[model samples]
Target: MSLDIGDALRSGIDDLTGEDGLLVGSVFLLYSLGSLVADESLSAELLTLVFESGAYTAEQRAMVDSFGGSPFALGVGLPAAVVLVVLVALAGELVRYWAIRSFAGPAETETDAFGDRAVMAVGLGGAVALTTLLFQSVLPVVGQLGGVATTLVGSIVGPLAGLVLLTVFVYLRQEIALNDGGYGETVRNSFARFMDDPASIVILLVVLGLFGLVGGLPSLVAGLAGGDAAVAGLPVTVLTRLLSTVLGAVFQTLGIAVVTDAYLQVRTSARESAA
Candidate 1:
């Protein structure tokens, strides 16, 4: 199947840039909140929350509080971060659904509402998160089997595994938005679609990765240069972040829209070929 990469790219950009500011603003807000919630700052309340959750005994919790909450405590911190990630993902899925439905002329609405799609988002996020944890958990075992070649390969394997899992997540999440099925049904159906044209999954990941790399360049350079760029006596980090945030918002909004249209087109072609 020949995908008109240029046409898809142009249409996606037009749809995203043609929208009002609200979509961009919403994306920025979600990304920003995710960064904020992931911060490691801890407080007495956080200490109680963390310790109270059984990271430590009751006596330990009390003792930790006696140190003026210490400079380090995170009761519920990790849990809160996890919840926030799910929330951000849910928000992204809602954006994807609303954008695809309105912009792509899907003309179908089986599971269109945000509430209906929440389970799908959680499932996607959970799958990705679990893939991460599972890979991390196996590192010790990998380490123990250490030969030089084995250790060398193991070092990059986790990240490579993550990248592949993420590609799967990207494809499946778009299906969840476009297909309008329950989580299990979505997974089964989407996997079948994936099997039909696995190349499409690779294409999706490459396009999305290019978008990310393009959007992230300035920040990337700054980080490599030590996060201290300046423009007109203003901190470069501030300006880079602002620019990156805007681009990230635009990239995500367009990425889903473009992929949704492409997915529909691909599925239609597959059915025709099958017949």
Candidate 2:
């Protein structure tokens, strides 16, 4: 029951164009901000490395630094973070919706799982934060734990946790539909589905790899260029930083889209086979 990759992508694109899809995209955009906030330390470090190393000009560095230690920064960052979280959530929902639509083949389901949607958005937002923290702090400490097991567990846990979260969302959606249930039921179903699909569990890593390849590279290059421009002149640096920030957002959005779409495809095919 392998699916056509092209059809799957087309369905996802079509979904992305609807009013609900736009809402989903908007939510994902918000949700992505949560990811950005969670990864602030990493973002900061990366920016510093890129800018200070002649990737950007001193003026550009100064502008980014201006937000430092400002109370208003929180006000600005919070809204942005919320938006990012919503974006990720919406993207995930779109994928799941498409997966269901694709598997069921033209059968329409009620888009009424508000509880499940809320739980998914909040849960995923938390997961994003936790995953960010784990990578930033836990993994480094794990490296110092001085054992192969500890190192290996530390290395894999965060990503695996993320994969599990993704699977849970998919599982919960289906289970809730089947059981006439809500959030708690969906959560339980998510755990069960993850356990049932080790192969698809591994598929997450592949999906993420592809995400980095397609969605990450453009921004990486953009950052490099922006950083270089920033170091060269003040005006150029300012523009460069601004452009790079937008570029980062775009890349993040696209990355989520790719991951959501691909994971949905995998989940849909697997579910059809199981049935």
TM-score to true structure, per model: 0.65, 0.48
Clashing pairs in 1: 49-75, 50-75
Name the runs in model 2 displaced over 4 angstroms.
2-6, 18-23, 30-38, 41-184, 191-212, 222-228, 231-275
Clashes of 1: 2
Instruction: State the lDDT of candidate 1 residue by residue for 26-110, as single tens digits.
Output: 6555665453333223223433444444656678555544432222223455466445445554555555555665555546435
lDDT of 2 at 93: 49
Off by over 4 Å in 1: 20-83, 106-108, 112-114, 129-155, 228-234, 273-275
What does candidate 2's lDDT look like per residue over 121-227, in tens digits? 44543454455545544464344344567657656775566555554554444443323345566566455554555465445445545644554453445445543
Worst 10-residue stretch by lDDT in candidate 1? 65-74
RMSD of each: 8.7, 8.4
Which candidate tops TM-score?
1
